[model samples]
Target: MMTMPSAPQLAVQASVKRADEILVVDDTPASLQLLADLLTEAGYVVRVAPEGAMALHSALARPPELILLDVRMPGMDGYELCRRLKAAPQTCNVPVIFLSALRETTDKLRGFTLGAVDYIGKPYQAEEVLARVRTHIDLHRLKTRLAEEVEQRTEELRLSSEELEEKRAQLQALMGFMHQVREDERTSIARELHDELGQSLTALRIELSWLRKHCAPLGEVVLERADAGYALVEQTVQSLRRISEGLRPGMLDVLGLCAALEHLVSQFAERTGVSCSFSADADDYRLPENGAITVFRLVQEALTNVARHAEASQVSVRLAQEKNSLHLCVSDNGRGFASAQPRQGFGLLGMRERVLLLGGEITIDGKNGTHIDVRLPLVKGE
Candidate 1:
């Protein structure tokens, strides 16, 4: 399965990884081979599928870093095929581009809404297509590598737990260590985004701003188009800001966990109209920065799920005290998950790691209403 992480929950790690392969699915063998050769020349490992059925089968065998699909195919057309590819958890993040003859606006929108990054029409320029494909494929690969490394370390720690005298204690310590590591990673990424991507995007926006002014003497239409480009650069800057914030909420570090939760809940309520309620008996108790931020992000992701996928009416976040530990409960009045579904998601798994770092136990109840309960050790004598 493709190890794709959520965009809102984009992982923070040492260095962003890059995609290694691209899957081109076209019924026409000639076209598929052409695209494959182009990508290979551009330093990408290319995989080809002659038909939609073969594409689906190949995707299942080993998901690609990105997919270039044809919209018009005899059977299992690109749109339908892309939908199925996206529906699979293993291939959801694999960027899909409808490299087809259809050029209508609606068709483009449908492709994008299905998570395709850039739609390329048939008889395309090879360079432009290669550029975008390279960009997305690299991004996907980076995230995949980071996740794989984290999972590997996690499994190694798990193996060591078998040798410990007290497995629970050992596991708790391991969880704490992992959460701290993850938090550190997020903090590092936030710094990098703000310092590198954020600064570069802003600088690009400024350059575009200069271009608009310099081109003003040329013609009104020229100036107008320059202005339009400037706006897009600014939009990209804002997108990076949001991405940085989601990685590590500036407020969680600038503000406390309680304040962060209050902000998050209010934001959720405003956006989702879900009436999110947050309470804290944590006035005097303070979690270590790592613990506090982890819990805050945990609640943030849970509420986001409620907003995006829960179809919940109301949600509650409670932070109470247990003996020597803090008890956090996030409950929602919503359609809960089916028991048979896989118990895996980067967000939930991250939360568990955070709680584990604090020597805590996490209980998730995906029954009638979704409930995530976490118990983490508190500051002594709290």
Candidate 2:
């Protein structure tokens, strides 16, 4: 039967398999061999060089994970080699530790300033050298791993943000398309009602009048009934006209945005018994069909909200054109509510969606009654 390896034995095997590569530089052969042997015993692959020149050449050829350098040598000393290594792009990141006879505070500071990670005395203990080497190697590996992780996470976040922006753009386009379809449907319905229903009611009224006038010696009760029928037909015609206008106002297409808004305000005041005023900077300003409808609908929705929610007597609407943008304001003297809280109704949400589709902005303030301000660019992509 075969026996499985113990935990300690498994650990040793794992460490050997993942052994770190180290470069040892010294002026004396004995010192280089001793350091190499010590590192080799610790499961690290060790490369030895007798002087600074050889060490530099070896490192340039194939850079090691960590470097153990000596201070005093014939041609190029450890300090010079360390400075050169740090300057080189390929070997700049490799950690270097000084193993030298010079143990003075100034010598250590000089080594550190030259970018040496650590300094050790000439009569170095085997255990201390091994411990310091192990510590620096582990630290360098951890730092490298951490840097890679940070870069990867940053890339992921950038991609995610880009994806989110793309999705939002797609959704905005869909909303605009749906809004256009709804407007077209409304226009079609309004045309049908005006042409078909309005004509039928008019014909009915004429027939009733003819019956009342031409009937020979008609009874008073019968004549009275004909008159009542005529009145009902007239009322039905008026109701149908009003409903058709509400679906899509003809003034919006005929007179332009300002005139349509004025008609809307006057009608609201008459119906709701709320005093409403409208003012505009320009009377003859014309907008495209879509723009005219958008402005008209905005005013209509605002006034509707005021009538339903505002318990006040007075309201004001204003419009102005400045440079390449149009500004609109609607305010009322009514009971106020907090604007920062999430809106409970879809009225505000619908308004926001409309403004967004036009690349415009809308703000609502309820601090002093209710005030709504809107700004829209006259030209698309401007």
Clashing pairs in 1: 2-90, 17-142, 18-141, 18-142, 19-138, 19-141, 175-356, 175-357, 176-356, 176-357
- In model 1, which range of ten residues has the least summed lDDT? 8-17
lDDT of 1 by residue, 78-197 (tens): 888889988998888778878988999999999988878889887899888988887776677688789999999999888887656487677677766766677679889989999998
Compute the lDDT for candidate 1: 0.79
C-alpha TM-scores of all predictions? 0.48, 0.78
Predicted candidate 2: what Cα RMSD to the true structure? Answer: 6.2
Candidate 2: which stretches are off by over 4 Å? 1-19, 25-31, 48-63, 69-125, 209-224, 284-289, 310-312, 380-382
For model 1 the TM-score comes to 0.48
True-structure RMSD, every candidate: 33.3, 6.2
